[model samples]
Target chain A: MNIDSIQNGVVIDHIKAGKSMEIYNLLQLYNLDCPVALITNAHSGKMGAKDIIKIDSENLDIDLDVIGLIDPNATVNIIRHGQLVEKKALTLPLELRDVLKCKNPRCITSVEQDLSHVFRLTDKQSGTYRCLYCEAKAERRN
Target chain B: MRSLIDILELSTQEIDELIATANDIIEHPEAYREKCRYKKLATLFFEPSTRTRLSFEAAMYELGGQVLGFSEAQSSSAAKGESVADTVRTVSCYADIIAMRHPKEGAPLVASMAASVPVINAGDGGHNHPTQTLTDLLTITREKGRLNNLSVGFCGDLKFGRTVHSLITALSRYEGIKIVLISPDELKLPSYVKKDVLKKKGITYVQTRDLEAVMPELDILYMTRVQKERFFNEEDYLRLKDMYILTPDKLHNAKSDLSIMHPLPRVNEIHTSIDADPRACYFRQALCGKYIRMALILKLLEIE
Candidate 1:
């Protein structure tokens, strides 16, 4: 497999192909004016298959928690001076705020428009997060 | 301070304290009107439960508190994929206390762990309804003028009636409290409740399908819906249902002091004619639910 190099940008690697768009939507990258190179069906010696998104001319204000929630395998590599300047692995946040809605119908956040939907990560091992008000489990949808 | 998470979390002394406090509130409502002056109670009902939610709101309002929160999931962020923990943390900031009803077991327990304020479990799945149990306790004490030495007959759907299980469990602690299980063979009380509660407490009891034969012996008749949905065959439901309906004619055999109670929104298990009878305490039971909740709020808030 040939490695593609970007002159100046950040590379999001190891995303399970086609999920890049979901990640894009989650990050709200469609609203950005910066050029985003979304590559799918890329070959990986390690992963057996992968996808890559190379965003040029802009650094992302991405939420690592959201990224970890969407796809835990993703890695972000920042490029400066044609070399990898920084590499960061995503971790789920201790608490999530206004990102995902609780599925529980009776939760206060479901009714109170002004209140932000919040969840506290209880068991990272199981990817279990509970609603702060109703104590409903916020299971990730595959 | 706001939510009644679990009955077990409360010690016997703590329960006694709440009961004593509830009695005080019942005796002197004026003294506690300012207790929760500016406080707000947010009832987040993920399930459809008008009775429990209304009682909770009425409880808070009676204590000079305000009420907010959604009654159904469609109206809330839950439909948008919001999580329970997040809702509780956020709601805690706005409401002084919260009452929650969910379809999942242990949901309120999860809320109680995350919430900064008090969290009450209105009811959860088929697991528990502590407030209902509390209301029953208050009603039994008020009606009988005591908790002990009462023969309480639990009729209709015993297997899935959360109220029956909770009330039986709570009543097991009092001395000389006898329980009579009245249900069809298919709707018998769960063995765990029998073994863990009644047998363990050495409480004497009997189980029978003959409601009329046993009516004269019971001091309290706790009636629950004999749900048609619980029956696999339509024929079986039709056969068993009419056997359970409490009519004014049936009360002729019952004791004059016998108080018939149902955790309401009753289907035809209880006939309308019985509502006019002095022995029908179910409506008053609803009022008791509010007063007990008022006591619960006052005790939980501890305004003294």
Candidate 2:
């Protein structure tokens, strides 16, 4: 790997090339003070094309389940003192809270301002989540 | 006593109580007025439903309650990215009850969980429409004077008709009810409804494409719009659009006491000429909707 090493940071790898922006927007990472490195269109033997984001700072709280939903192929690597400290594989959450919007037009969440648009994962393998309130399934788009 | 999020949660006695209350309200309108004098109803319609929204507002007004809330999603804070739970929680503080219509299938269920006040599901996407089911129940009882041993025909758009699904489920709980399903092959009732409600309940039913053939045998004919959008091909829509129209000629052989009902805002399914007939019960069905809702509001609020 010809990738530059980060002294102390978190590396998110194997994300789909163009979808890193969506993951970035979802996490609101741009407003943070940490040094962030976003690598796009990277080579991957399994994926053919990939992207990576390396954030250098203290341990930041990010919802990896959401990132997995946005790009399931992605992996997270925690780095410490220029060495890989911990590597964790991401999976979709059993119940998603305050994340995606239920696409159903008649869903009460779409009208009520006070309710958190929550969904419970009904099928993890198929990437199927049902709205907790409306039972509307939120399907993962490939 | 509170919000009605799912029909599965309502027992047989509770449904009967609601129906009885609705009937009482229909009979004596003055007795229930000012029942919820200082109360307010927040009708948060996330989708476009002119009929359901108006009915809910009318129901509230008839109870001497004020109505607030938007008719569409664009007019609400949801477009500004506010969450459903937060919105209901806020509205719960302002209104005594909330009647919401959302495109998402379980939206009202979600709102009910967060709302401190009673949350009524006016409608939700292609999912359940309990209120419509209640209206149908009230209509059938008032028209035929009974809920059981009747041959009911559900015609047109059975596949996407949430009201049809709800009605079938509600009626299945009763004894000796036979169903006649009339629709094009492309718009046959969904298998889930057939397997879950009709077949499981041991309710006898016959499926056909001819509406007139079944019209004479039916005690009640529930007509729904066969939308142009439901057809994938333009030619299929054209072929089926007029396939089930209930014109005067078709009603010649119909039962004398057969009540024609529609969960309306109909396009061309029912001819205007039939409106003058005694069996044309859709307009009365609309009024029944308001009374049922009025009864519902009174019951939920415990206003007697």
Candidate 3:
């Protein structure tokens, strides 16, 4: 498959196999006006089959924390002046605000209309995030 | 402003200080009588808890502080669809510090975020009750003379009992503390608590359905009522409920110094026959609640 490379944009590389769509949706790249290329099951030496997303826009601001939580191994390459300006790696964030909703029905955030659903990383090894209020473990959308 | 939302927010040193302060208050009640003469405490009980509410009121009264606010949601602006943040913000203007109890979990947290003054959680659903934990710590300290180097057994409703969870979390901070969990298999301690709190902290603990079997090894016995609502069937509830009742017989092999503690308004889980027992500290625990709360109020108000 042949796809045009972006002149000035971000290339999200080394995503785990079949996870590009979830990342793309969570990142809200689908709503973007600029051209976006999602390449899945691409052969790679490091990852047997990896998914990659190339955003063809320089002005787009991406939330690296979202990417970090989704796939810590993924690398983000910044493009400026049609050249790779910076390659960034992401790690799990200590606290996440409004990213995931607390599924606990008894949680105060569930009733409080204006309250933010906050979660803190409890276990990094298991990728566990628990609700700040009720301590209900966050169920990953995946 | 500082708030008392979770027991973990207070360190072991701070807890020790609070315990010391509570002991001082207990010893010299006259010394703290006029400590908060000009300060006011707002008891925002969105849920009806007459016991905890009166505890706060008595604490404030003993500290020479006036107390205000509603005892139930119907009596407060929360019934008018007022947000916790708004209510707390309004209450902060009328009072020096706020003690809030709401039906929803983390309501006190939201109040803390919004209030200008300190907000203490009286009880927030099945979430946290820091003052209750403080009271328990005070009770245990005064009873056993130390917080560490003892085997503490918790009986009944480990799964949904907020007090048990909070107390476990508080006791986990102490050294040489072993937790023996006693509850029916249906209402056994949650694995997440064991895994997250016990195993993560490297604290020694054991689980069993039989309470009498381990009664001899306990220095302090913390008991919580196992509500029938927790069980799906009447048969399971009937069969398991009586197994945890603390009767004279249950204390047969137990240590004479075992501090039998319970959060009050307890039903048949504790037989009235055992009220005369020297180890029955649940009623005394309620008294300790006021002293510790007075200490907490003084700490929050920065009063002498």
Candidate 4:
């Protein structure tokens, strides 16, 4: 598959395999008018299998921290005038607001639809995010 | 200025201060009778709680503060699908402070975020009940005469007992605090609690299935009821039903001075026979609940 690289855009690489669709939906990349390439099950020496999303738009402004929350291993490469200008690695955000919804049934956010799903990164090594209100552990998604 | 969401939010000194204030209230009730005269406390209980709700109302009333709000969800706008944030935001306009109890774990936390006044989490599901922890702490300090250097054994339903979890988290902060967790393997204390709080704090603790064996070693024995509602399997509940019944025969092995505490509404965990035992302090624990809540109300309102 010959997917063209963007002259000035962001290439999100090393997303966990088959998670490209989730990333696509979360970032609302489908709403963008620019050409977007979502490559799934790409063989990689580091990840064994990975998903990569390449967005071909200079004005595509995405919160890279959000990508970090969803998929921490993913890396973002900024293309400037067809050259790699920045290779940014993702880190678990210290605080997240409305990125990942709290799944605990007893969490207030579950009953209150208008409340923002807020979480604080309690443990970095284990990637533990606790509900800001109920302190319930955020469930890990496959 | 802040909310009491978790027991860990309080420092040992703050806890001590609260205990001291509670002790003062016990000695001179008339002094605090007019503290919260013009204030109002909104008790937004979205769940059925006899002791917690009443204790909060009693606390506010004891401070001469009026109490309002519903005792359950069906009576309130929450049943109509109003959010916790909106409920508290609206209640904040009516009351000087809010004490909310919900079956959901983080509901009061969501309330605290929106409310302009201080929010007190009365009880939130199987999550933190800081006030209960405060009540337990005050009870222990009063009964044992010291908070440190005590071998405390937590018995029965350690798994889903929010009181046990909060007490363990709080007690770990005190010096010479040794915890003996006595529960069946199926209902043992959660590993995250063991790893994050106990081990991280370097608090020496041992887990055992035999309650009788550890009973003799404890200076304080905190008993918790095995909730039938928490179990999905009926057979599992029946099988583990009578694992640790504290009878007079079993109490013989325990220390005479062992301060027996329970965040009550217990069902068959403690025999009625043990009620006469001098060590049984659960009733006193309940009374302490009211007093500590008064201190908490004063602290939150900054009435001192």
Candidate 5:
């Protein structure tokens, strides 16, 4: 199978297999009017099985922090006029704001309707994110 | 502008300063009578904590400041579906400082973010009660004459004991503070707490189920009530509520000068017989709560 190369867009490569859907949903790719292609279990030389997302819009601005939190090894290539402009590597964010919700039932974010759910990175090795309000560990949604 | 959401927010120097101020208040009560004159404190308790609410009220009153606000959520606009942020935002206009207690953890944090005036976390569910930790610190300093080099035993419901967690976190900052965690397996202290507050700080701790065996090893016995409000099942609460009753018989092996302290509104976890014992300092802990709170109010209000 063959997918068309984007003229001006972003190519998110090196995603861990089966995580493209999560990245797509978190990035709200469905809301974008531009044509988007998600290639799963693609062949890679460095990574065994990788997922890639190709966004066919030059003007689109996506949250790289979301990608960083989910898959730090993922790389983003900015394509301009069918040529790679910038290749960017991702790292875990120190703090996430409104990107995820606190799962603690007793947390203030659970009761206060208008409050923004915030999580702070506590453990770098474990990639542990704790709720800013109650300090409850944030579990990644499967 | 400033808030006391966690006990760690206050530095050791600040804690010492507050303790000194509380000691000064105790020695020369007349001098602090007009410290907070014309200032107002709002006791915004969304939960039904008679002791903490009254402590803040009494603290402000003793500082020559007036007090206002509701004791429970039913009496406040929270009953009308108003948010904590909105309530405190409005309360900031009327009061110089706000001492808020809510059943939802981190509600006071939300209040601090929204309110213009300083906010003190009186208590917030089973998450944190910074002022209570300060009270415990003051009580310990008064009883033992020092905060460091003591073996502190925390008994009862360690799982849901906010005071235990806060005090441990606070005391972990001191040198030579060894924590003896006494609780049944079902109500053991949470691993995250042990890691974040103890292990990470390199504080020595020992977990045990047999309180009697560790009784003599303790310098300060911090007893906590198994909170029924934190339980989803009544049967579990009933089974664990009476687990660690600090009867006089339990004190035979304990040190004669041991500080038997509890964040009060105690259930049967501590026997009424222990009340008359000189080792019992829970009542004195409550009084320390007021004085430390008075210092907290003065500090927050930046009063001379």
Candidate 6:
């Protein structure tokens, strides 16, 4: 299957297999008017099998840090005139506000609907984030 | 300027100073009677509490400060669907300081973030209870005469006991503290607590199923209630509830100087006969709660 490559857009590559849809949802690519392609279980030499999201839009601004939270190993490439202009890597956000929800039922954020869910990165290797309120570990939703 | 959200937030020096202040207050009650005379304390309890609320009220009254606020969420604006932020903001205008207890884990934290005045977390769900930690520290210092180099046996519900968790975290800051976790297999201390607080600090600790086996080596035996509310399985609660009962027979092997402590409202964990024992310091521990809370009130209000 040949998905058309855009002249100017962002190509999110090297996503772990089967995680392209989550990245797409998090990036809210569905809300954008531009064409978006999610290639799942694509053949990759670096990662055994990878997922890729190609957003065909110029001058589109997305939070790379949030993308990092979704899939840190993924690479973001800016394509200008169908040529790679800039390549960026994702890193774990030290603190995330409203991106991750605290799963602890006893947490104040759960009871108080208006409060923003804040999670702070505790373990970098495990990619663990703890709730700012109750200190309960935020479970990554699959 | 920060609020006391957790017992872990207090430094060893601060804890020592608070203990000193509590001792001073206990010795000279008249000296601190009017220290917070004009200051008002708002006890915004969004949950029903008998001991903690009374302790805070008694502490403030003894310090010549006035107390106000509701007993439960039904009486407070919280029942009217008000946010913790808005409630604390409004209470901040009425009172000089706030001592709040909520059913939610971080409700006081939200209040602390919103209130301009100092906010004290009395108790929040199954989360941190810093005042109780203060009370425990004060009782330990007064009973054992030192906070360092002691073997503390925490028995009964270690899993869901917020007091046990907070006290263990606080004790990790002290020197030469060894924790003996005694409980049935079902109510063992949570793994996050073991990893984050104990192992990370390299604090020496041992987990055991037998309380009597470790009784002789303990300088402080802290007992916690196994609450039915904390258990998801009723059968598990019933089976594990009566596992460790500290009676006169159990105390035969215990150290003579061992201070038996408990965060009260206990249920059959300790026999009534054990109350007469000199080792029983749980009552004194409760009284110390008032004095330490008095010290804490003074410290938070910045009153000399």
Give per-model TM-scores.
0.66, 0.71, 0.94, 0.94, 0.96, 0.96
The order by descending lDDT is: 5, 6, 4, 3, 2, 1
Give the runs in model 1 whose Cα sits over 4 Å from its true position.
Answer: A1-142, B1-3, B227-243
Q: Mark the 10 consecutive residues where model 4 chain B has the least summed lDDT.
A: B225-234
User: Judged by lDDT against the true structure, how good is candidate 4?
Assistant: 0.89
Instruction: Give the share of true interchain contacts found in each model.
Output: 0.00, 0.86, 0.77, 1.00, 0.86, 0.91
Query: Highest TM-score, which number?
Result: 5
- Candidate 1: residue B225 lDDT (0-100): 84
Residue-by-residue lDDT tens digits, candidate 3, B1-304: 5899999999999999999999998899999889999889999998888989999999999999999999999999888999999998898889999999987898998889889999999988888989999999999999989999989999988887889999999999889999999988878888988988999899999999888999999999989987664455789778877677788987889898888999977888889998899999999999999999999999888876
Residue-level lDDT tens digits of model 6 in A1-142: 7888889999999999999899888777888898889999999897889998899888797786678776777899989999999997677788988888888988999878889999999999888899999999987754
Q: How does model 3 score on DockQ?
A: 0.76
TM-scores of chain B, in order: 0.93, 0.95, 0.96, 0.98, 0.98, 0.98
Model 3 has an lDDT value of 0.89
* Between candidates 1 and 4, the lDDT winner: 4
Candidate 4, residues A46-80: lDDT per residue as tens digits? Answer: 88999999999989777776676678778899999
Top-DockQ structure, candidate number: 6
CA lDDT for candidate 2 = 0.85
> Which structure is stronger by lDDT: 1 or 2?
2
For each candidate, C-alpha RMSD in Å?
Answer: 10.1, 6.8, 2.2, 2.0, 1.6, 1.7
Interface RMSD of each: 7.0, 3.5, 0.9, 1.2, 0.7, 0.5
User: Which DockQ values do the candidates obtain, in the order shown?
Assistant: 0.03, 0.37, 0.76, 0.78, 0.87, 0.88
Residue A140, model 1, lDDT: 78
lDDT (tens digit, per residue) of candidate 4 on B147-261: 8999999999999889999999999888999999999999999999999999999999999998888888999999999887667688998998789888888877888899999
Off by over 4 Å in 3: A41-49, B228-240
Tens-digit lDDT track for model 5 on B96-154?
99999998898998899899999999898899999999999999999999999999999
TM-score of chain A of 4: 0.88
- Give the per-residue lDDT of model 1 (tens digit) for A1-142: 4555776778889998678888888777787778887888898899888888887754666674577787888898888768888897677898988777887654555544665678898777867788765556786744
